[model samples]
Target: MATELNKGPMLGQRHVQSFLLFSAITVNFMTKFNAGVAVVAMTDAESTNPDFPEYDWDEMQRSYILSSFFWGYILTQFLGGWLCRRYGARITMFASTLGSAVLVALVPWCVSWGGWQAYCALRMAMGLFQGFVFPCIHAHLANWCPVNERNRLGALANMGIDCGTLVSMFASGLIAASSIGWPGIFYVSSGVGIFWCIMWWFFGADTPGESKLISEAERSYIENSISSSHKAKEGHAGTSIPVPWKAIWTSVPFWAYMITKCCQSWGFSTLQTEMPAYMNGVLLMDMKKNALYSALPYFASWVMAVVYLIIADILLTRNIMSITGIRKTINSIAFFVPAAALIGVGFLDSEQKTLAVVLMCTNVGINAGSTIGSTINTIDLSPNHAGILMGIANTASNVIPIVTPLLVGIMVKDNHDRQQWQVVFIISAVIFVVGDLIYLAFGQMVTQPWDAPDFLDKERSPNLQEEGYSKALEAKESTNVDEAKRKEIEAGLESEEPKKKALNDEL
Candidate 1:
């Protein structure tokens, strides 16, 4: 591994793969949030550019349009996992982005022909394709990232979400106000998506072994590191292990993670989808100011995500915390601090616009800690099945996005009413607090028994099975030791061989 490292550049092919994944996520989310900004120009008479057409959508209608993406999104999460496991992340992500681009281009015509209902249908179609993205990304990272570097590389990839949201919110406003008008938002986003599809098709890969672009040295380093960590027999190329669905469903830690995921989704969707409207209605900000302020929070979020990554690496490399402790600690900060800031935001009056912006930024920025926390917990629990696990969790969590806007529509009858918006913020805060508390009580970062079910057969005695598992891990780790240590381990194994053979004969 040292020789391989010396032979390659300081940054390897894996870093290139990470960068592409980051760009893929950025493009995907740009399309995802484009509607949030464009909706202002589409509906509000005051905000609409004179050159563009405006629709008279009521609050309920607007809510439907914003929430519609999750309708089809929910249906495909599990399927995405199956597809990724069966095929590969490279093709799955490529297909998703290409389909989403085509659908985005059709948005203006759909809305023009049939109004909000047609627009909702188009968004739903886009959701079906885009739903595959996250599962594929998780699976890809599991294959490409080393155990030690997981948090840093994972953060780099996930930060694309914030980058995408920032660009969409900030740039969509300018595009909408240009000579091309509201339709320009869809056009520009679609064009970017298409361009990304071209790049991903040429460069994206599922694993280091499969990539022609990767050096042999880097590939050996990644595979050896991952194999040592996972301690499972690597299967043949183009095949997958059977999913332990029953085991996953029964796991306590998985359930805890899922519940927190749902809560985070509810709060995140509420803010991501409705914040522009909040700025327009409550703060009375115009289109340009609304876009700029809404985008600023995500910029803070992107920056804070990097900070969280750095802090997490310090705690890990310095041995300041156990892996479980690190996960719980980071997750607690991600949830509790944001919950407090959200509640604070609710109490501010319209005159406290600057304070409200600060609070909202705090809420969103600190929330980025989740990327290093529960977001990557699926990978920790079972790297081999991370994609499928993500699929299951995402399917349940994304339902909250569908529910949030409708709930907001029912609660906030008057968009300009500060009291109603206060109620919405408080509810989100309560949910966030409750979910993190559950995770604190029940969540774990250790790999579960079921992660390698084939190795630990049900017929084995529990104590014997656990002892054997430890021995196997020790054997794998022995390979990385110095020659002196390696010789000692070999001698020890040879000494036990006669007893092992005698025991086997008796059995």
Candidate 2:
């Protein structure tokens, strides 16, 4: 039997999972983006604060370093989804985080052994280990979060990205400025990742049922609120369902999501990895101030992400707008606004440093609205296959991370050249607009037919639609019979009434 929903507090074991996931993500991104900051610290020739010698790495080598991680990142995306489906989200996420932590801890040693080559190798390994993060999170959230809470919870979890970037930017600068130098950034980040893994292992579970910590009422409410087909019932071990690869591949809305995600990734990747470098190379900012500048945009992004989440939830809960309308509107703001901001950034000169910082802040801050748009759409499209769908979409989109840095590296042969930087921003803005247009045209928020566990079987069975029609016909006939009986009773009453009137006249 379906459990009735309580009208009170929504927090419980599920929220714990969200918080654990958030911590893990924060650590994950902290380690992932440590390189973004460390590279700036490592390469900045003008910085006198470093205790260790700075590398004379040019634009191309740094690009190579930044892009190498995605090579391994892209390799494991599909596998991550598969693992999430087979082993459950808890184990996959655990493995990803733990392995990434171990690899991150080893990065300094690896760099000592092989210089840039070793650094790139270690970064790739880190990506390989961490590639499962998104698919696993999607899979986990699918089980734990009810439809009504999906937007708010998912956005909250992803806010870790902003927080992580902020910390990495701010901390890396101060640490690099200290006697510990550039390597301290990696050590501190790795330590945090390791700590988060320990917490996750103890507190995290794949589903509410698996969790010993969740109250029975909340567990029942969660199970009953989400689609029953997606959850395993009592006394039964959950089994993996087959993926509808064909339908997913053919899905128009999914492709729109893919395109938009790729566009966002490009802009995000370019800004995240390159922004600190831009601050150092173009604006001639010191390492500490560079970190502060890099951190500010992410802080704003985090704040706006929460704002978008609140608005989204209100619109959804109150029926103020349809899901599709809200998604499109929020997504448009995310893309179009950022697109304009980036153009403004491209046009700014060195004298306009303050204006440039503001534009950069606006670019990332508004992009946070996408947390409500494309980020949660996988669940909307297919609650059952959310993980796999996310994997497929992310796989298609992850190509951007590989391409963006390399392209930026090539284009900005001289990092100090503002014209080259302007071209990069304009190109990114164009991609963002193009992606937004595609999403507006083809994006859908409703569940697709291919989301069913039996969708493949139904496709193979030629008589399925016919069988549905037959059932409908039977129901229609039954309704017709009842209607005919009702009419006959009305006719009998009418005839009796007329006869009674005639008898009264005769008397």
Candidate number achieving the greatest lDDT relative to the actual structure: 1
Q: Which portions of model 2 show Cα errors greater than 4 Å?
A: 1-10, 45-48, 234-238, 463-507
lDDT of each: 0.86, 0.84
Model 1 lDDT per residue over 1-507, tens place: 665453366688888888888999999999898888888889974575777678999999999999899999989999898888777888899999999999999998888889999999999999999999988888888888877888888889999989999999999988887778889899999999999999988888787877888887777777777742342134322244667777889899999999999998988888899999998889988988888999999999999999999999999999998878888888889899988998888787679989999998999999999888889898788888888889999999999989999999999999899899999999999999999999999998877777773633552578788999999989877765666787899999999999999999999
Reference-based lDDT, residue 292, model 2? 88
Instruction: Give per-model TM-scores.
Output: 0.88, 0.88
| Sliding window of 10 residues with minimal summed lDDT for model 2 | 1-10
Which residue pairs overlap in candidate 2's backbone? none
Report lDDT (Cα) of residue 90, candidate 2: 77
TM-score (C-alpha) between model 2 and the true structure: 0.88
Tens digits of per-residue lDDT, candidate 2, 165-191, equal: 889888888888887787778888878
Q: Which candidate number maximizes TM-score?
A: 2
